[model samples]
Target: MANVNDKYAIRMMKADDYEQAFVLWNGLEGLGLSEADSPERIARFLQRNEGLSFVCEYEGSLIGTIMAGHDSRRGFLYHLGVATAHRGQGIAPLLVNEALSALLREGIDKCHLFVMEHNEAGQRFWSANGWEKRDGILLYSRGLESRGLE
Candidate 1:
C-alpha cells in the first residue's frame, strides 16, 4: 500500500475502515446533506450506492477519502473530505484525481457534483482542479418526509 511518498498510501476502503472513515467524513462540511451521520446511516448509504471509494492513509492513519458513483448517464461524486490536520499536504487533489480517473475508466465521460451555493471554498477547489461549472442548472430534492417519496 506504500507509494513513492512513503508516508501516504491510497487504496480502496474496506468494511473494517468504515468507523475511522466515518469520523474523518463527518468532520468535514461537505456534501450539503442535512442529516448527521451514524454508523447505521453510513451503512445504508453504502448499500444504496454502487461505486468505488479510495482512502488516503498517511503514516498508517486515515487522512482523506472520496467516493464515486455513476448512474447510466453520468458519474456523480459524493463525500470528498480531508481531515483538517491533513489539509495543505496535497492529499485533497490526490483523492479527487483518483476518483476522476476511476470514473473515466468506468466509461463515464461526464462527471458532476453538487456544492452548496454557500460553500465557496469547495467550489473554488473544484474549479481550480479543472472541473467545469454549468450555469442555469438547478437542483431539487425531496426529503424523507416528502409526501410522495415516503
Candidate 2:
C-alpha cells in the first residue's frame, strides 16, 4: 500500500482490523498493551461503544489508531499510536478528534487518558494537543476479583 501523498483515511475500527492494529500497537513504545487488549475484548468494546474508536488507514494498511469509550460518567482514551514513518504528518490528532467527536455526540464532556511518565514522546503528543498533566493525582488498579468490584 503506497500512500505517497501522506493522505490517510479514517474509519471505525472493526474486528477484522485487530491483527493489523495489534501489530501496530506492538511497534510503538510505551503503550501498555495487555491481554485485555486482545481481539475479543476490543470487539466487545467497539460493540458496546459504537463509533467511539477509530483507525486511520494509509493505502489499505492500518497506520494509526485511537481507542475511546465512556462509562456514561467519564470518557477514557487508550492506546493511540501512529506509525513511525507517519509521525509528523498530523495523523494522530485527526484520529483523536474523530474519537472525541463521537464521545461528545454521546453527551460526554470530560475525557481522560493515561500517559506513562517516561513516555516523553507520548507525553509530548498529548501536551501538544492541549491536554494538561494534573499534579497531585495518582492512579491505582487491581483485579476485579481481588477488589470485589466484580
Candidate 3:
C-alpha cells in the first residue's frame, strides 16, 4: 500500500459515488465513457462486484477511482483515473493496489486493463507502475444492438 497523507482517505466505492466519479472520468482525456457507464449500469456493477471497486477522496471529494471485476478467472480493471491536480501524489497507484488487493482476496491472480492506443500518459503510468505491455494478442470487440439497459 502506498502511503497517503491524512487528508486523503481510500474506501470502497458505493452507488452514491456515481455522479462524482462520472464527472471525474468525463474530465479526463483518455477514458472512454459510454452507455455502459450510466448510473443504473454502474450501480449494478457495484452490486455485482461488491468490494472490488474503490475511490480516493480528499476532504470528502472524490479524486481517484478504480473499478475491478473478475469472470471467475482473470481479473479486469477499468476507469482508473486521478484528478489532474492530484496526479503526482501516488493516488492512482494506491487505487490500483486497493482493487488488485481486493481481487486477490477473491482468488483472482491475473489482471488486465485497457489503455487507449493514443493515451501515452496512461501507457507510461501503467508501465512505470510494473504492469507489462503484452504482445502477440489483440482485443476484438463487437457491439450488439441494445435490448434494454445494456
Candidate 4:
C-alpha cells in the first residue's frame, strides 16, 4: 500500500471508469452489493443518472467510489466505499464532501444514508463527520428479490 498523499486523489468519474468503479463497488459491505456484480448494472445506473458517481484513484487505479442521488424528499448516499488497502486515511470524507457539495448546490437541505444496524464503525464515522442520527425515522426496505429484480 502506498502513502495516502502519494497514492490517491479524488475526481469526477468518467465514462471509461465504469469497469474500475465496479471492482471497487463489489468490495463494499452493503450496496445492493456483491463481489460478483456486473459492470452492466453499474453502467446502466450511471447512464440513467449521470454525475451521481465519483471515484477515488490511487496510483492511477480506482480504489474507492461513492454514489449519490436525490429525489424530492432527501438525498441518498450509496456505495461509499474505500478499498481495503486505502482505509483510515481520510479518503471517504473527501468523497462524501464532493457528493454533499453537489447536493447542496442543487438545493438539497436534508441528506440521509443507511448503514447496517450493526455497523458501529460506520456510525462513528458518520457522527465524526457531523451526521446525526434521525431520532424516529425507521428505514424499511422492500427487498429486490421479493420484487424479482434479483
Kindly give the stretch of ten consecutive residues in candidate 3 with the minimal lDDT sum: 141-150
lDDT of each: 0.74, 0.87, 0.93, 0.75
List of clashing residue pairs for candidate 3: none
Model 4 RMSD in angstroms? 4.4
Model 1 TM-score relative to the real fold: 0.81
User: How high is each candidate's TM-score?
Assistant: 0.81, 0.91, 0.93, 0.77
lDDT of 2 by residue, 42-91 (tens): 99998998888898898889999999999998899998999999888888
Q: Summarize candidate 1's per-residue lDDT along 1-150 as a digit string, tens digits.
A: 324277878887655677888778667775454463566665665555534567888888888878777785798887788888768878878887787787788788888987877878899999998988999988876666656764
Tens digits of per-residue lDDT, candidate 4, 1-150, equal 223486687877666787777777666664456432356766666665567667888888988887777885688887788887889888898889888887777788789887777767777888999999888887664545567665
lDDT score of residue 47 within candidate 4: 66
User: Which is the better candidate, 3 or 4, if ranked by TM-score?
Assistant: 3
Candidate 3: where are CA atoms >4 Å away? 1-3, 146-150
Winner by TM-score: 3
Candidate achieving the largest lDDT:
3
User: Cα lDDT of model 2 overall?
Assistant: 0.87
Number of the candidate with higher TM-score, 1 or 3: 3
lDDT of 4 at 75: 87
